[model samples]
Each structure stands twice: as structure tokens, then as C-alpha cells.
Target: MALAGMLLVAMTAWFVPWALAHTDWGNWWLAIPFVGCNVFVACTALLLAFNNSKRSIPLRVEVARGHEPLVGVIVPTASEPVDMVMATVGSVIDQRWPEDRLRVVVSDDGYSDELQARVATLAAELPHGVVSYFRPPKRGSAERIGESKAGNLNAAIRLLSDANCEFVETRDADDLVADPEFLRLTVSHMMLDDRIGFVQTIKESKTSEGDPFNNNELLFYRGMMLSRNADHCAFPCGSGLVWRRAALREIGHFPVWNLVEDIHSGVLALRLGWRGLYVPIVGAFAQHAPEDVANYFKQRGTWAIDSIRLFAFDRFRHMPWRMRLHFIEQTAFYLLSLPIMVLLIIPMAGLAFGQFPIDAAPMDYAVHFTGFAVAMELTMLAFAADRPLGAFVRTRVFLIGMAPLYAASTIRAFWYGAKKKPIYIVTRKTDEHRVYVSMLKAHWFLIAMIVFVLVMSARRDDFLLDFDPGSIYWAIVGLTGLGAFVRLSWFGVDVKRNILSRLQLRSKPDSHVQSDT
Candidate 1:
């Protein structure tokens, strides 16, 4: 529905320029916003390119050995299924570090009695003194308070810190650690440098099947995560991140106010003059959004809200000169790109009323649009330096397709987040394939608009640019962009199609699965 509406708006936009051209509004108003957005995108791409060129830190030795700092892995989960939760716990227990030395703290943010029992079972099965479960005092629903991932995490930190755990690690219930040596590798670095208080590792995807629409979300995330190394100051990601307990204590602990604690904590760490390290080692893998588009938006909304807060609140200014610039550049890149996306829909909306604006002053629109296109190309080239040509090509299109959607959601999140009424909704995850069968009414309309553009471009032969090399290049680029929308549904259709039907999958007994708050 949302997509269909956007298409209609886009089609309507074709006529906006023509209509406006007839009037005396002049091209300056339209050109100004469009040009401003273009420059923002171009500047961001360049900064990211600069960040990706720096040095990567290596793991230190014997950091997890006896008598060393006791590293605790804190996992907070809500409503995740039994199997996946267990897989996460097992992964932590199975790490190469000494079990006796490393402690796994599972915080059951879920208020469900059944899930609590599962946590009990996992704790019992583990070796003596290796794993412990902490249940926050149930107030209202877990989701409303401690059940929320960030709140639950703060609860665990208070518990472990009291227990004298020197350092804390945070991971989501669904996340998998690909490298068993994850703790040893990362802890070694932190131990060696007291100044380096927080460390986050790059995330990778191992699963081939996912809900078709958002399967590749993780790939884009990974690409962005790897690109952070270029900035010297790394951003904090929820999973595969470790923080020093003392540092947390100094900052008054994780702020429970924000949906994304990792980001909040990262900015706080920098303010305190503590360095945050980005380790390129593949520490974790996890599932992407499988079935629900709403859930996908909600997840993205959380990040966007936090990002905006980070900048609007002047959180980055607390950092040193070099580190502060990176955060500012990164945040500006994100917010600026969003308005560009939202504005594109305006031109579309205009075309629906027979306003055929693009026809009135083709040359002017062409010039403005041409500049935007070049800015996009520069953005792609900025990231293309480190990416495979194939992946880079696909990501560019994906970024383009997501612009409008991202813009809309960011606005919605900001509005709700400002009121502090945005609910923390959990995403449903099953090891089954789900198809995105319904193109929103809006999406269908957008498709029609695209078709209309093609037809009009063809009928008005002059509208179709000459088939020169540059035209051919743009044609390929545009088609690849169209592919991004189709790719959104690729994972779930491919992997989880028959997963549930093939097996009589049983929900593990509460006593058998661990539930972390």
C-alpha cells in the first residue's frame, strides 16, 4: 500500500515541472533543495571513503587466562524461540576461552513463565559456575521495561558489576559467533590498551534463506559495518560488542532511555576519552528480517531515531577532534540523504493530476536531475573501493531503492521517538521461508508510474535521450536499481519456503531453553 502510493506520487511528479514551468515560481526553489541533497550525499560518500582507509587492530594474547580480568557475556532476549536462544547460549559456552574464567549472563527480559523455565534448564545443563541467569524483578510486561533489550541489558550490567565482572559483552539471542576465538581475540586488545574501552566486530551472514523482502538487509549492514573501520572511531553495534565494566560505571551505566544502547554507549565512551575499536574479524552471524515489512521498518526506526538523537543532542562534540568529525560526518550523511528521498515523492504526486511538469522545461529538470545522478555515482564510488564490483553494483541500487522508504520511516520514528511513545516491537523469526506476496497499494501505483514514465519516454521520442554510451550506462544502472526492489524478496522465497512443513518442529520445553532479558 505504501509503495503503491509512492508510485502514484512519482507518476504525478513527471508533470510537476511542466506545470511549474508555465508559472513564475522559477527553477531556483526546486533546484536549491535538490542540489543541497545532492551535495550532502556526495560529501558523505567521500567521508566514508576516507574512513575505510585506516589501520585495523589485531587480537592480544592470553587475555582470557586465569587471574586475568573476568569477561562476562551478557545476552538479553525477548520472545525469541527456544531453539535459536539455545543456539546462542551454546555458542557462548562453546567459545575457545576457559569456561571457568568466562561467565555467561542470560537476562530474561521476557516476562513469560514458560521462557523463564527454559532459562533454568540451560543454566542447569551448563558446567558448574560457568553460566548464570538473572531475572529482573517483574514490574509490568518485560517488553515495556526490562523486557526491552536496552533496559534488560542495563539490569544485567548492574547484576554483573555487583558480582565484580571486570568487562561485559553484549549479544542478541539470535546472533551467532562464527569465530570461537571471538572473546580471546577481542579481549586481548582491550586488555592491552586501557584507553580502548569498547570493541565491536564485523558481522557476517551465513544463512541463505530468509523472508524475501529483507534478507539482504544484513548484507547492507555488513557492508556499512566494515566501512566504519575507515573512521578510526568505531560505532557501537548491539551484537558482538564488549565494554569495560569500569567504563560503564563511569558513564552512569547504559542509558535505558534509548532503543539502541550500543550507539548511546559508543558516544558516551568517546565523551569520556575512551577509545572504541572496530575489529574486522568475523565474530557473529545472524538472521535478517524474514517476513514482516512492518517489523523491518520498526527495527530500522529504532536505529534512525537513535542516530538523529546522537547528532541533535551534540553527542559527538564530546569526542576529540578527529573522532568528533567522523561522527558528525556519518550522522550528517544519514539525515541529509533522507530528505532527498522524501522530496522525490513530491514530484511523483504532482504528475497524477495531469501536471506533466517534466515536459515544460526539460532542459532545466535534466540539468538538476543530472547533478543528482552524478552525486549518486560518487557515493557509490566512495564505497566501491573496498567492495567487490558485483556486490558494489547491487548495493548501489539497493541504496537507491531504499531512499524513499528510509526517509518516510526516519520521519515517523523521529516523531514518535520525540514523544517517547514509540513502542519497542519484537520481530518474528522462524527458520522458515516467507514470501512478500502483497505489494502495497502504493507500490502497485508506483509500478504503474514507472511504466508510464517508460511509455511516455518512448512515445515522446525526444524525451528519450540518444543511445549514446552515457545513455547506455545509465540504462544499465537504472535497471540494476529496479532489481533492488525485486531482490528485497529474494531470501525468504529461496530459503524458508518449505522449512517449517518439512519438519515437525517442536517448541522446546521451557525447562530446556534459556530466556535472557
Candidate 2:
């Protein structure tokens, strides 16, 4: 599959330049972003191919050295629901590790009195010293610390010093342990391989039935992580990760200031010659997947921006050449969104303006492109999903719709830089049965573009004839954009009921309503 993808990329590289050179369009500059977009797509195919070879390896359990090592399970929360926080605490308590060797710490940055009381009550009901709570110092206090999830976690480390645990497991406030043996399994790997700095477990979504975005995430964990693991570059995700205290200390603690701290930590560990492992088992369940379009954009955008910022870090400069290239490849994947959007829209713009760039017939281009696309899609489906091709196609539409949001995020990352204060957006459990006006507003430009193209196609008689290939391509692009718009604008029946109620009240006068009552 990898070889086939490489062949396709080689073909694209040759065909794109040849086709562009044959065009009579004077504006050669328009092809620059298109070329860039194609290059990124080819790189993605290569990466996907390389990832397919890395299957998960099983770990052998090791004999204990006299006594069980102490493990500190850190749960970081910032204004999350108390019930959710407590549920996570309960899950940690249910782990298969010895009770005496386990310590659960709730790192609450919100510092709320109600939260403190709840934790206190919950702790009292549990085993003595098994559960504890820590809060960052007050903002103006002498011991005040920097704010963010990283900061909250640093504070937890400090609070756990007395316990002096050999290993630390980081869990997000909303994440629950799916397997009671999660600790035993991950710890066994660490014990077997002393050089293993951290072990990352698979993060499965709480729900992914009807959500393509969520399905993509599941694919990422199942397929991509396997590939990364094969390369010995598997990094810690935001949650369900266990780390060795010695390795973290060697790396000078978590890069608290870095936005994508988990990745940063993983890279630093790798650079320092410490190995990281990927446990393919579903260790924990978390709300990492977005429930709606708005949340999806927000989560992906933040990740893109933060991941891009890693290039500026000084530690990244000292990594091995191969490691550096891998990091660059990862960042490039996130930053390709804008270029892709430009590539898609430019051809349509040429049609609207009577400046069709490509001289070839639409069918000719489609013939070659469709074969390569189908091959790539088949490779992906083989590795990522067990479902039919149609399901994968549907998920891909959502992925393509995300280009604009990713482009916006890449631009923001460059404009703001890494030094800017990081603002964490909490992912909430939202009702997908409602239409969020904000989500629609975010994609207004795409919606407007789709409407404008349709209007032009309908109003002008020569529009299709004058630009034969261009107009056809424009129709295809417009339909794709429309599909994205409709999928995102899924308004439930409640919206209609509310509108009807408003209309009924407006039609009735105040005096008439009172008389009727």
C-alpha cells in the first residue's frame, strides 16, 4: 500500500507541473498554493502508508522487585462539574493496583469553596489518605503559580512529594477508567522496559455512533497510533498516560508553558534517549471527541495552533534529524488546511471570472485523479475502518469540511506566536439535537460562496458554455461546500416548534389573549 501511494504521489508531481505549464493563464501565481496543497496531500499519503506497517506488539509481565511501587493517579480539573470529577475519582479507586500503593490526587485550579467541600466529603468516605485534593496558590499569594492544565499538574506533583510515588498516571477530570487492569497492564510494560519513559493507552470516545468527527478520532487511535508506535515515537495523549518519575525529572519537568505539553514532553523524552510505549488496549474512556461542529472546530483549531508552536522551541532544535523531520511532518499536516481551501476555491473563482486556468477537459483530469484518490481511500479504509466504503466516504466529507477551520487556526498560530497566554476551552457534553447559531456563523463565508456560485450558474446563460471545464468544476466544488453546510446546519424539530410558538403569539393581540384566558 505504501509503495502504491508513493507511485501515486510521483504521478501527481509529474502531472501537476506538466498540466500547469500547458495552461495559457497569465496569472502563474495562482498555481503556487495549489502546488503546495498537492504536495501536502502527497505527504499525507506517504505518512498513511508508512503507518500501516506498524502493528501493536504485546508486552510481557515482569516479576516484582520485592514490593509494589507507589503510583499516584493525578486528576486535573478546572471548573468541571463536581459529579464528573467524583466519577473519575471513583474510577481511579476501582483500579486493580494495591490500595496501599495507590494515591489519587484531585488537582482543582478553580479553587471553589463548594468544590473543596465536595472533595472533602468524598475523601472522608474513602480509605484514609487514599484520596487528596490540591489547589494552586491564590493569584496574588507569594506561592502563586502559572495557570493552565500544565500548571495545575505541576502543583499536583508538588502535593504528591510526600507520597514519593515511582510512577504517575495523568487522567483528565471527565475521563473514566474502562478497564480495572489499566494500571496493572501499563505498569507491567514500564517494569519490563526500564528505559520506557511513558506508556500511552488508547483513548476511546464515550460516543461515536453517528459522529464522523468522532469516528475519525477512533481511526487515529486505532491506525495512526499503531504506525507511530512502530517508529518508537508514540507520544502521550492528553489523557490515559502513565509516566516514570525519573524520566520526567531528567527532562526538567513538563513544559508547563507549552500549549501541547503532552507532545512536547514526549518529544523531549525521545530526544533524551528515553523510549515511549503505546498500549493498544482501550485503557480509559474520555470526552476527547467533539459532540458538535462548534466544539470540533474549537478543539482541532487549538491543537493545530499549539502543535505548530512547537517548532519555535529550543529543545526541538537538538533532536535527531529523523525525529526533527517527523515533527515537521506532523506540523505540516495541521497547517495544510488553508492551502487546501485555496486550491479548492481558486478553480471555481477562475470559472466565475472567465479565467479558467486548466486547459484540459474536466473528464480527462477526473480520470487520472479519481484512480489515485480511490487507491488512497482504499488503503485508508483497509487500515482504519472495518465498515463499508460508503461510511469512510461520509467521514471524509466531514474531514474536508474542516479545512477552513484549520486554515484559520494556522493563521492564528503564526499571528499570536507561542508566547501568548494559552486559553483552554473545556469540551462539554453537548446535545447534538440542537442547532448552534455560532457554528453556522463560523462557516458563513463558505455558505455565502456556495450561494453566489449557484446564483451565477442560474442567472447567466453563457456561464456554463464560455467556461466548460471551469463551470463543471465549480458545480462540483459548490455541491461539496453545500454538503458541508447542510451537515453542520442540522436543525432539530425543536427549532421549528419554537418558531411556530413565536408566530402564534405575535398573531394574537395582548387584549385578545387576556380575554381568551
Candidate 3:
């Protein structure tokens, strides 16, 4: 019913406008995807207004008094820093749950000697059998399928099968469980509710005042998908999630077929008659946002690719109606990148060439589009969680910058759909201080095209000499998107401090070998 309502809104908004405004039948293919995306965004902007997810919800089910079940904690690491991993394990140990009831399995996928040694020493320093280091048996040096996170997790959980753990909680190597009583709350919520396969704790990144990266996900997790709370469909958001052991067994373990095991598991769990509860309360568990832009891209790219693949696989149609509504919006969210390029290019081509794509005058098109877009953006601002203006700008700039990555990822997903498998590289928790010019290759090509268009259009009398109102309007639109792209990918070309001595082929005049001689 919700899906029908959304489709109705989109068709009414788009088809009516197109019927009155469309110039050419050939252009429908060019324009529908772009306009359809705009309609979807407008719908989201409106839907956010009804967001009453801020109110706390009481759990419907709770464990019987004194029925504390043993929880097997799995900490999966992939060459992560030993100190950070240790800190995460230490935080788990500090939980108020009985020390004997909690078993920590450090799934060491990285196979680093230092990490193995450190965990052993740390284990000895603590209670006997409280924490154990698990080094997965590597079938080959060349990392193959099942050697990734999903495989390590499957192995780790299997080791706990003998221990008869009723509950299993996954904690990333970089995340720290913030509250000592967090497990009690999460486990209780799943006690009587056999349908609920997992309880996902909301990520708390800005535990400190100085969160420069602003990894806090209040809007995305709490507000954006608040509607899903009613559906009991809050999917996993990386680490800090607890799963029912029986549910995992039913689903045949974590989704090993895809790169995005987190969301995949949630979707599969739901399909297998299992539901998930997402705790919206703030500060449930601590996991910082991406500290670097490159790492952020890697994280988003992996997510986007798998989302496209899943949607393309006809799995969306098979999902239950309650779970189906959100995936439409979710898949479209990632797919929006392609249509955005189409949206920008249509107007950009108009600016470059005097002939507009549609039959309507440029002014009419611009005015109508401006009114609709402004209304949508304003609605988004009204519901925005923080600094509305800054958030708006950040979002647009990010969308503009990520267009290339999204486009490439979409192509990459299709490229590997049937043939070679794509390797899932773990996102680095640490920041990437070094900048690579190669990363901006797509942006460079885009900028070059924009400059060429403007230069060529300047020489044409009809292009801008007569000042066509439509041309001028579209030029502004194109330039605004381009400006956002520039703002994001602008790595200044100043390498004076970074220049190697060998690149200059010169040595310091004061340099001497007196001591060696």
C-alpha cells in the first residue's frame, strides 16, 4: 500500500508535466529517469515531515527475570591496529554482564604476528578463557572467496556452536561498546520475539566534542529510516549489532555471496521469516565515521555496488511487501547517481547548444524546475537534524563529487555480475593523509569538458551573445553543480613540501660526509 502510494505520486507528478511539456517522443528515454529521480526526492522531502521517530519506543518483549543467556562476542579484524582491537575487546570485557557469561572471539583474519602475540599476552593479563585469539586457517596466500569478513565470521560463530551460545553479537575491531548495560537491553528486546533475528544498536560516533569527520548517523539511521521502525526493518549498519543464534542458523549463516554482508544478512533474515529491531536510542555503541575521503568512497562504493547487484537480481520483487517498500527507495538512492548525471547533462547540453532538449522555452522549464526543486529543498531543510544550511551544502557537494564513483561502481557491479568476483577490501578506519592525483581522473575529464563547452559557447553569437534567458538559466544550473564538484575534488597543485630530493636532482649545499670519511 505504501509502495502503491509512492508510485502514484511519482506518476502523477511526472506524467502530467511531461504530457503538457514534452517536445519530442525521443526525449522521453532521456528525460524519464532524470525526472523520475526528482519526483522520488520530492517524495522523500515530503515524507520526512511526518517523521515521528524521535519518540522512544518501549520493547514489546523481555527476557524472564534472571534469564541471562551467554552471548558470544565476535570481533572481526582485518589488519586493523592491535591497540584499537585490544581496546574494543577491553570495552566488551567491561560490560556489566557476568565475566563468565561473555566469551570474546577475536577473529584474526589479518594473520599478523604482532596481533596474535598481543592478544595472547592480553588474554593472560585477564581472566582465564575470557578472550581467545582465532587465526582462520588460510587455504591459500591469494585471498579467495570465503577468506573475507563473512568467512571469518562464519568460522568464529561455528567455534562458539559447541559452547551453546543463544546470542551472538558482532563488534568491529574499531568500535567500542559505549554502555555497560547495552547488551541487557538488546538481549531482552529479542527474548520473547522469536521473529526478530537481530537487534541493531544505533551507531554513536560523536561521543567526543571534536568529531571533525562528523560520523554521527542520527539523521540517516534515526530520522531517515524512522518510518521503517514501524515495519521492524532497521537493517544492520556495520558493527555494533546482536544476532540470535537460531536465526543465524536458519539463514544458513551470514550472507557469504555478497560483499555487503551486513545488509545482505538483514534482507535474507527477513526473507526467511525473521525480523530485526533497530535500537534508535543514542549512544548505544561507539563507531566513528570515515576519517578520510578516500576511505569514505571505498565504503560507499562497496555498499552501492552490492545494492545495485541485489536489486538487479530480481530479489526485490520476491521480498515481502512490508520489506519491499524501503528497498525501492534504498536501491533508487544509490541508483540516483546515474540519473543525476543525466539531469545535469540535459541542461548542460542545452547551455552548450542553443537548441534545448524539450519543446518548452528555457525560461518556462527553468521556472517550473526551480519552483519544484526549491520547495523540495526547503522541506528537507525543515526536517534537517543539524545546521540546515551546512548540511544541505555538504549533501549537495557530496552528491556532486560522488557521481563519478557511483557511475563507475554501477558499471563495475554489472561487469562482475556473472564472471569474475569482486574482492571486498575492508575500509580503513584510519585517515589517508596522502593525496593521490589519480583518484581525480574522472573529475579532471568532467572539468575539461565543462571548460570546453563554455569556451565554445562563448564564441557562438546565439549561445550567449543575445542573452537567451533559458540559456542563462541553465548555465547557472550547470555551473552550480560543477562548482560543487570543484569544491569537493579541489586538491591544490602545490607539492613543494612533498617534492622528493631526487626529483630535483640536487643535494643540499651544506650536506657533508665528514663523519663517514
lDDT of 2 by residue, 1-517 (tens): 5556566566666555655665545655554555456556767666656555546565645335445688998998888888878888888887776777888888888776777787789788877888888887654455644457776777788766778887999998888898777887788888878899999988876655655554335566666666666667778887889999888789876775666478888888998898888887777786545656666667777787778777654437766664565566667667656655765677657655656555566566555555555555556666555445545565466555666677777777777775684676766555455666566553566557756865775678775445454344444654675466456555333667888998999887776344533
lDDT of 1 at 237: 75
- Can you rank all candidates by TM-score, best first? 2, 3, 1
- TM-score: which is higher, 1 or 3? 3
TM for candidate 1 is: 0.76
Backbone clashes, each candidate: 46, 0, 0
Instruction: Sort every candidate by lDDT, greatest first.
Output: 2, 3, 1
| Model 3 agreement with the true structure over 219-258: per-residue lDDT tens digits | 4664555556677677787677899999989888787677
In model 3, what is the error at residue 285, expressed in angstroms? 5.9
Worst 10 residues of 2 by lDDT: 465-474
Number of the top-ranking candidate, with lDDT as the measure: 2
Relative to the unseen true structure, what is the C-alpha lDDT of residue 271 in candidate 1, on a scale of 0 to 100?
A: 84
Give the CA lDDT, 0 to 100, for residue 23 in model 1: 38
- 1-517 per-residue lDDT for model 1 (tens digits): 2232333234334433433444333444444554344445555555554544444444445454564567788877776776777788889888787776667877776655766676678778766756777776553655333336767777776667556777788988888877888888788777788888788887755444432344434433445554444444687877888888878878886766566677877888778888777776777777544344445545665666667766765467656666766776656545754754534433433332323323335555554455445544554564455555656655566555555455565676567554364566676675343554363334444445655644554555444442222222334443455445644543345445365645534543557667795
- In angstroms, the error of model 1 at 398 is 2.1
Please give each candidate's TM-score. Answer: 0.76, 0.87, 0.82
